[model samples]
Target: MIKITGEHHFAIDRTLFVFALDSEAGKVFNEKNKLVTGIGKVNAAMELTQEIQRNRPELIVNLGSAGSRSFGKGEVVCCTKFIQRDMDVRGLGFEKYETPLSGIPPVLEYGLLKEGLPQGICGTGDSFEMNHAETDYNIVDMEAYPLALIAMKKNIPFLCLKYISDDAGSEAAEDWAVQVHLASEAFNKILF
Candidate 1:
């Protein structure tokens, strides 16, 4: 397990695994070729961008814990579509979640789907969603959108596996804290 904090780049395997935090990686992922990109979209985008520049990976696999009302806790699901949930440019005549002047679509349909696993639409934003009333996305995450967008632009295959840790409800913070540790194990079972 590698924590990507500084600008230094490390040698990684063909399939690069990415995690939002070290704790989310857990003990089982210690031997795997992984990068801990910290939290939030900017961190994820910067770290992933650097890694790709240093050594282009054959495929990028993002594994992290997410909040969802539609999925049960401890269940690992694939995310094929990503949304920048915080990008609201409605006042500028652009639609909500649409990046102004950027050609990228509001809903990014990029990510390799895993067979037998159910798929989800991830809404990536800076804030931890709690009691959010949005009905568009089934999953709420902090970093998956940028990772998916970057991979899509680079034409590299991307696979997002999110372990449902919370329900994006009033008790999301508490639930996530307790359930995040189990996400790594669930992902290990699915991918490793």
Candidate 2:
């Protein structure tokens, strides 16, 4: 269910825009359809589920800051695939990223792709990635995997847009602190 469309054709009213923090989305969006779902996967899933129970949104859109090594700072990327970076079950005779008994694959490969944006395979986990080692995903974040799964289970449209706030390995914390606030400037151009 991946499709790409330009911002001019996007319907903001029917979309529920989600963020990990208010600071990430506060500058551009209002309270109408915005949801700030704390940080981790549990919080993201829980909050999004609660909101869905309250009112069914036509689309679930996740907009947040992410760390990337390949992409430059201030770049807005469209993430169509999500993987649980922390799910290590190799000790249990399962694959490294595979969930122990879950039917879902390691990567959740369904999302709405926005036009004119570079695509990314996002790795979602609880910890902020300072220097990510070997991994299949190019983008690192804390919430997108669960959000994409929830949207998939509910059969709602989902879109994930990430602003590159820091270089994953290179002085990430300091760079993220200075760059996270500027995320909205990049997102506003594409999403507003």
- In terms of TM-score, the best-performing candidate is 2
Best by lDDT: 1
lDDT of 1 by residue, 44-135 (tens): 99999999998888778899999999999888889999999999999989988899999988898997777768999999999999987788
List the candidates' TM-scores in order.
Answer: 0.92, 0.93
Candidate 2 per-residue C-alpha lDDT over 1-192 given as tens digits, one digit per residue, 9 for 90 to 100: 123473424456778889999989856787448899999999999999999999888888899999998889999999989889999989879877788888888777988878889999999999988987755999999999999999999999898999999988869999989898988777777765
Off by over 4 Å in 1: 1-12
Q: Count the backbone clashes (under 3 Å) in each candidate.
A: 0, 0
TM-score of 1: 0.92
Tell me which residue pairs clash in candidate 2.
none
Question: What is residue 81's positional error in candidate 1, in angstroms?
Answer: 0.4
The 10-residue segment with the lowest total lDDT in model 2: 1-10
